[model samples]
Target: MTTWDEHAAQLADTVTHPRSRWRDAIRATPRHLLVPRWWHNDLTGTLLLDGPTDPHRWMRAAYSDTTLVTRLGSLHADLAHPDDRPPWWPSSSSTLPSLIVRMFRHARPETGQNILDVGTGSGYGTALLCHRFGDQHITSVDIDPYLTATARERLADIGHKPLIAATDATGPLPDTYDRIIATVSVPRIPAPWLAALRPGGRLVTTITGTSLIIGADKTPDGGALGRVERDWAGFMGTRHGPDYPPRLMHQFPHARDQDGDDITTGRYPVLDIAEAWEVNTQLTLAVPGIETHFETDGDDRTAYLLHADGSWARAHGHWTDAPTVHQSGPRRLWDVLERIRHKLNIEGSLGLYGYRVHIEPNGRCHISQGGWTAVIE
Candidate 1:
């Protein structure tokens, strides 16, 4: 049987180059310790896997370059029973190792710089940072007290004593830092995060509802300017409390099969909006706060778009065929999706990558690329 050290070495080789600065850190840290148990989602439901009970499977999962869901809703996998199943979406996860390396590369932290690691879900990222940089220069924060406490203990057990605090990342941070890298997504850059940046500091994070990774340097005007990275990544949105607000599930049934106020045949084949990251990003930028759901029964596919404002749209059809769309409420949801698809088909891309980003001191972001511009408030 292969040991965890061997697995870590293999993972290091897979995710980083031989000369990569992160290679040593990845190989040194024991991920299995940080994530002793996690939830594995299958076609049936989310299942809990305890590391001690199945060491081989646990080692395989922990060392793999994959995100491990550690918590669903308010229930941590450690506390869940064998048969326990939470209906909510994943609220916390140990982000994939490669993406963590990518975000750190974007931040470009140096030896003497103080770093803040936001959303310390499993403390795996924090452990890597502690290994690469000294523990004294690292501070990690998460909203859940249980997560922080457990992570702090687990990290200490591994001979790392970084400051791990339980605090809302969207609000005031504990202290200022030269580099801030968030594993969790935010609706926009938090004003406190902007205020907490030291002079000549930089930040790397992803926008909520999109797979956009942005890196920005502190500006003399107390703001920051940067651009959307070419690489795409997604993270769970930051929550202020134990769990996120209930999903927009209440609107699903009505939008699932019922006739809508407006009906039409879609100009294109039915597509899973959530799976089409770029198209989904465009739609999110065009209309914020929209929720999407997709399902397929055999060859018949159905997609639904719902909003908190009581607007909904459903598209149903056979695979690769034009869908019959039903839309209702104040705005035609299907029309918006169609327009975005049309733009992608004509332009060949959404052009979100490399877009210039200007963030105000108050955290409002102005993103522009050529003739296109949008603001996130």
Candidate 2:
């Protein structure tokens, strides 16, 4: 039987190069201990994989560089039954090891600096950081008490005793720090986070509803200015409570498999938001709360867009052909998307990743590059 430490080394070799400083830390941490039980998709529904029940399957999942959904909606996998299937999307997970390393690479952490690890889901990332920069210099926080307690206990077993607290990450932090690395996304830069960061400190986080990775440094004027990182990454948005806010699924009834009020031909090609990272990122920034779904069969492609306030759009067509677009409700959702597509067509790019980001003391985000500018208040 391959030991967990050897499995950790194999996982590290898969995600990190030989010369990477994070290699040793990844090799030492035992991920299976933190995530003893997780949910995996099955033909019928989600299947609970208990480590004690199936050690082989558990070891494979634990050592693999993939996300393990520990909590779905408000249901934690530890408490879920074998026959249960949580309807809601994943609320928390042990993020992929590769992405965790990618985030740390972007952070460029210095030795002996105080670090705040936000969204301590499974505390795997926190444990890795603790090993890199002793437990005294690291503080890991999460919104759920149960999750924080679980992580604290698991970290202790691994000889790590970082300060683990349960609190809303958007609100005031317990202490200041030289670095803030959030594994969760935020709609806007929280003012309290800005206040907690010391001068010359750096922040690494993803913008909510988009895949834009922001890397900014604190300035003397109580503001931060930086550019978007070229590589894109996304995580579940931060929540103030146990679960996220209500989704736009209410509009699904009127729009699902129904002809809309206005029907026309789409001026652009059919786009799968999941596959088109650049366009999806731009559309998300332009239309903040739009929900998307996409599918394809042979040469035929279909896409649907839904938004709160009763706006929806559906587009269907074959390859290289203009899609038949159907839209309804207060806003013409497809038209808004088309306008963005037109802008992209003319400018050759929306420059979303190239935008200069400015974070004000009040958490207002002002994004601009070239002659284009946008503000999120």
lDDT winner among the candidates?
1
What are the per-residue Cα lDDT tens digits for candidate 1 across 1-377? 99889999999999999999999999999999999989998888778889999999999999999999999888999899999988748999898999999999999999978999999999999999999899999999999999999999999999999999999998999999999999999988999999999999999999888999999999999899999998999889999988888778564677877899999899998888888999988888888998898889999999988888888999899998988999988889889999999989999988879999999999999999888899987
Instruction: Return the lDDT, model 1, position 323.
Output: 89
Per-model TM values vs. the true structure: 0.98, 0.93
Evaluated at residue 144, the lDDT of candidate 1 is 97
**lDDT against the true structure, each candidate:** 0.92, 0.88
After superposition of all CA atoms, the RMSD between model 2 and the true structure is 2.1
TM-score of 1: 0.98
Model 2 / residue 127 / CA error / Å:
0.5
Note the residue pairs that clash in candidate 2. Answer: none
lDDT of 2 by residue, 89-147 (tens): 88999999999989988888899999999999999999999999999999998999999
Q: Which runs in model 1 stand beyond 4 Å of their true positions? A: none
**Model 2, residue 168: C-alpha shift (Å):** 0.8
Q: For model 2, where is the 10-residue window of minimal lDDT?
A: 247-256
Any runs in candidate 2 off by more than 4 Å, and if so which?
A: 42-44, 295-301, 318-321, 342-349
